[model samples]
Target: MSIPSLLSRRAALLAGAFAVAGLSRPGLALGAARANPVPLPSADQIRQDYQQMVDFGPRLPGNANHVKFVDWMKREFVAAGLRLGPCESYAYRRWEPKRWSLDIIDGDQRHAVPTVAYFVRSQPTGPQGVTGPLVYAGRLNPDGPASLPDFPKGSILLFDAELPKMHLRQIVHPHFIHVRGETDADVLDSLYHRLWTMPSFQMDDLAARGVAGVAIIINASSAMIAGNFSPHASPYKPKVPALFIGQDAGDTLRAAAKAGRAAHLTLDAQWVEGDVPQLTAVLPGESEEVMIVDTHTDGQNFIEENGCIALLQLARHFASLPAGQRLRRSIVFAGWPGHMSGDMPEAPGWALAHPDLMKRAAAAFTIEHLGASEWADVPGKGYAATGHNEYMNWPATAGPLNDFVIDGIKRHDLLRHAVEQGPGYTTGRVFHNSGIPHVACIAGPNYLLGIVPNGHMDKLDADLASRQTAMIAEIIKQADRTPMADLKGSDSSLGADPIAGTDSSKRTQCQAS
Candidate 1:
């Protein structure tokens, strides 16, 4: 049997009876439901929801597919008996980079340095399609993460992965950043259009400092290229060669910079100004402050798995859900695009706006990966990011799969899985790394699936994921009976979920088969 299959077989033994007698000690609230609990959402339903998403062709940021995907989402939420307020965020145009590239020579060898470029309003003014001598100024601020300080006018940036995270940190800078991982095909195919807003440094701001072009390196995951970027909600236009390049190609530019030689760069990208309309779908609940089931509506331009379609599946499930079963906290089936206008708003911006909502949120479950076979358990329900929300604590295990993560998230239950997986595995590599929207403040700090997966995921079944969601729904139901107030309790309690202790490794008693 295949590894996935054998693993699935093992998981079945551990979780099978859960479906028969109960599932993972259903974390339901005592007598929360008026009657025998309403049946939760189902797998066939989840499967159908996901399959629909796969049908939309690459839901790239600027395409019509993205817009339509959003419309369908809003409709699903509306059908689910949600009050549907002002569509929580949509209708914004982002600039996309058209022509872009870089040039380099190492050891007497010359080749056009490949790059995935960005669109800056004033940076690409050196006349598009123009090839000029590239200037290498050596590394700027060597102590800083991969980056060069000042660039001679009309020079393209060539830096390494060590470059400070583009939008995540603070840096006073100007230089057409040329990342080290893009290639000619990535540009010709117009894949770079989406990333024009990532650096978040303003073009005019950089231009005043003699900035020319920008490039970012995006590594390849095997043969497939990671999608360039999402649309920016910002109104600013970017200028420069917003380009991406492969790792090896970017090194040449960095080498030239290190040697203090003029590195020549080539420009082949053009800026096409226009707006691809965005869409939104809302599933309403009983509260003014809402919890979003957010996911990007756009799909990878060069990949499969319909992102928007998968979101729609969830929306439909919400719609099919009886009003009483849906949690009192609003669940917006949020649909979003994938391009940035160099805006600092961050991914899933709508959800980040409300402090009160983040504090009181029963829980928020963000879903991704519509089809893969690693399906397993969602995390605990207590995983909802608490204070200033960021990666609060590592759950300690990679999770029984993804369901446990989902469950842990919805219920804020972070304890159960600790014994199964070790610390590094839980917080994996660190807190912020495993999760993107992490607990913002660590000092006083707090804080904190599915579908089309066979194997281990299938072994537990989609019901496992739904069970988690349902458990959360139960928890939320329990909270609804209390005063509409702080989740941390009156005195700012440490949260209901306790910090779990480590469980010594369990030795499996194996019998020779």
Candidate 2:
């Protein structure tokens, strides 16, 4: 996808690294029970580590960058004195780039130009040329934007990114995003869900209205830009080809159709579909319980350079940390296979099979977009990806991704950092949906440029990342050695690893030395 116009297209330079947070005394809550409950990390080092991950760029799953990312991370971990346990790795899905262009000839009036756009499978490519009568299907819904003149079945349809911001109620009306909840009344009242919609659904809705080729306005919704609408479409696939037009370039297509010019389209696409291997590495401790640290190793196929940068970068940081910090609870780092074009609607096959491992895990941390300075507010709190899949049963929801800023704010104790976030309902919805007790955090939008790496390129506010990582490092730093409680009810559907469900004979005291 093209970098947002608001975001720097050129990875420009800013000044200064993140200002380091000073460490005061640890919170005095331990009664010979907990080991200094809260320990401040070496703020300086943590910042440097964060900057390195930011250099990786956006990680869109199911791309070649993901593969390279796995390689880089594994090597880094090994060098860091961290031992790699068995990786629970596999690939389940894939997609390739499809590009298109148009040639318009209106009697004597002729115009041919590129359309303003972004691609789902958006990647740099040589454009193709074709000609046909344009069909203006208008926006996504009949109640949506207006339809263009001469809009007909089997004709090309154009869309605009400037959707009429609807009440969150209209967005979650099952027809839009299919989100229904009891407490999101406040957020629903405020948010405009039109920013994000399934490409396939938008295409199909147009198609159902008797339109053919689809041209969409490709603005990566400022909120949720995690692309790949294949999952929503996997169930009932759409037949028409679709493409995105840049907002600036869309005028050519619109003008041609408006002036009654012959509308032609050219699509040059290579849709690669199959199993692309994903990587998983683990560091096992003697404990039966499990704790997971995971991230998607894949990246955008278009911007292939940044493929696995974050995955490998983070992996290296963890491995380089004190190997002595290995937890007794199995710590498995999972590289999720299908983030973009994935269709494991049910529990991951691996997760479904190993009920025992999942049952044993005390908590999980699935990493995505490693560190962004800002956070979107959660609608509320709940877990997704629960162990019990049947009926309305989800299991563990006590992890970082379920509550994105959680580990950093709560576990890592980045309080002031948490205060900086706005209450935009984002990733935690999936956590609650899947019963995965987790937190989901993406890089803060432009606001955090100085606080996180790539925040101010010259400034490179990496210090914040370092402090955050150190805080997390200290928390996971003692997992294996920490004392774990065995209760009757525990949710363990965090990752696909079997270790999530390991049960111990009795209570074990693991003191992180």
Candidate 3:
């Protein structure tokens, strides 16, 4: 059967199920009664869209690929029958690294060590690079002051950095629920929170100490470390060049540092000021109130920001519907850039730019990091898949909005998911903070922020993403039929605190992750 016929059959089945359940709401009845519901893109179509997006390369803000991706999105939106909205443009200093290397020089013998990745916005080294005596500093505490050996000026510092090892049970947020996956005790070691946080927090102190350069030895494999580019959220530049050396080369580099060998460190990069655009497209509905669908366009790999493709799929579905069959509120498709740029996020900026529209918004949905497969660093072996979809978080505002999301998840069989309280991590936090009802679905796989050799293209599950998008569409339809007052409800709490209710003595010192 054709995709449209299949979708119509599915709609008929759903309508019959609702009737059998005795659901008599006007919106549900109207949705069920429609003879020809617009067809949602098939799983195969969504897969094609995802592949096209991955082919664009890493969509880091203000880069050539990012610009091309935005232009492509604009064209796709127009082709899907969405009216092009404003493109919010902003300027910032963009960093592009050419090449970097680290070498240990012991008298006449020189040893080249494998350098994983450089910290974004770190001070750049010239072509010749900087040479200095290597000094072993051990682990630098992110919490408080620690006694350290004094180093002479113009010496390179090597610090041992450990990535946090987490068990599934340790994710004990009040709203966090472990739907299903690996056992609770399975290690979740690829958490990159510290990779950038430690460096960002210590950059000023390192500069104050007058260090010529810095190297952090992380506990992951060379491939994993090479893919990581953490602390991408910072706008400030550090004074000294910095590099991340993976665990494969850790002992060698550490022994060289302890041996009082001279090392040459280079981070050949430059910052160029440029403008990046944020896009918004509108699909007019029967009423003036709007339901905004948002996602960031900048990321490191395929799964990082694939939400825009999902957004495109949704735009096509809604646009194909007959005008009379459309929802009561207009739908705004927003694609914000600079998510990885460390500048002020474009979501809130767009919200602030159009206050009148914000007033008319009934609710907002932000989607990101969809269809991610869970992967973790294995001891001795390297990064491998865990054969399950990453645990997804659906954080929604308290009240009917939250209930609607849960119901949709159940109806669509979106397993391995959690229904958390409002305003988790995505750009949807803007709507939650501004008193607009909001819900966002996002997943954080180990490779979410990493630019890997395969581009992490293998990490996406097209069928899973299609089901998730369909659930969102169902929820939007339900919301369109329900009264605005019922959807918003009366709850005022936006979200749960990151560190609230935890014991200070037992809590991890660095909570940035």
Candidate 4:
């Protein structure tokens, strides 16, 4: 059945709730009323689009599924009567992991322990694998390898690094500073200030020392592994294999190392030059100033697919409007595939290829996971990814743009929830660094970004998605109405500092290490 038909049936079933929420009454969603010229999207439409993306399975690079989804998107855009730009095409080197397993060979028995995740672009440990004594590298030098003591050259070095505790703290204590009337940027800044103080591991040190491999332990209770989205494009090159292991596994490895035990590491992953489509659909307006609405088209599942659907919804909405009724500023809808590959210039993605457009953009509205389940920690149960009343993280560029989003959230009566972020990379940083106003509203417990495995929208909150999409549409409308100078802000030093306490100046855009 057609999506509109399905949505019409739902609108009838939930007419009362829509009325109470001040949403258009019944048939108004189907056949537009005389009140509003452009009908706001119904919850049913958002849910349907999200499900369609999920049905396509994962859209990660180096897979046939990625190509399939990209083709599907192009067809959808053309159907919406949008124009694809020549700069949409992008290619990059992608890694394909055939067999990735690590086991501790003790005496005659092997214990299979969980690891955070495999490092991106890490060299494989050959079919035979490398077995060596485990060595504790202690805290990584704040300066670098030059400040560290020497360890065995061929040992598997293990060390500890701080995980993003701000989000976790919000989940545990929501009443702390996550109250209403506060911008997400303010809340994030409060939490992320300590992040800059933490020591960062020098991966180059491992390669320089000729260590077989290295493992990092993030100080988190959950066993989720987090790492750079595009490790291969990182400025620092590592000649050895590396992975992030949870605290429990790290403790075990440290104990084993203290007891003079050995570890066998293996990473059967390969990296080669590959190409994936990067797309952009332009809806021209009367003015030259352009507003960008984008999201990554590739991820494990709903974590990013929901964002893509939002982009599609925006495309459909703008395309439906008559050219004369279109807004003043042009709108560019971007669907980037290599966003998972670190979104670097060298990585063959949108940001690297479109510097002129990036610089000229007045404001950007980036959509990631819209309606995601929130995760919580259970004392004896470990981490549990549950709850429908979860909050989203909206990281906006500091200054007037952030002020505008905060005011809009209240004006639109969006649900008051903490804006906690997860451990994943995004395209927001790139735009922010270039002094472009950017806003991102993403849901919590994103499993694709490695919050934890098994976080899905079981009882999908269609209302939340609708409200979020409406807010984004509102932001775009306001951007179009407001002058470019006002939306872009006057402060040149705003995005010069790295986003959320990470030194992104060194690494290419789109890193969450």
lDDT measured at residue 452 in model 1 versus the true structure, 0 to 100: 19
lDDT of each: 0.35, 0.38, 0.70, 0.58
lDDT of 3 by residue, 17-71 (tens): 2223221111211222224644775778777888898888888888988888888
Which parts of model 4 are misplaced by more than 4 Å?
A: 1-44, 61-63, 141-153, 164-200, 221-223, 226-235, 286-289, 322-328, 346-362, 385-404, 415-448, 451-462, 483-513
The digit string of per-residue lDDT tens for model 1 on 461-492 reads 24433443444344334444433333223221
Best by lDDT: 3
Model 2 off-target regions past 4 Å? 1-63, 81-93, 102-115, 118-129, 142-154, 160-199, 202-212, 217-237, 246-253, 301-326, 344-350, 353-356, 373-464, 477-483, 486-513
Which regions of candidate 1 are displaced past 4 Å? 1-63, 78-91, 103-128, 140-157, 161-227, 230-239, 251-315, 321-483, 486-488, 491-513
Model 2 TM-score relative to the real fold: 0.57
* Model 1 collision count: 96
- Span of 10 residues, lowest total lDDT, candidate 4: 504-513
- Separately for all candidates shown, the number of backbone clashes (residues 3 or more apart, or on different chains) is 96, 82, 0, 1
User: What's the true lDDT of residue 347 in model 2?
Assistant: 21
Please estimate how well model 3 matches the true structure, expressed as its whole-model Cα lDDT. 0.70
**lDDT computed for candidate 1:** 0.35
Quote model 3's TM-score. 0.83
Q: Is candidate 1 or candidate 2 better by TM-score?
A: 2
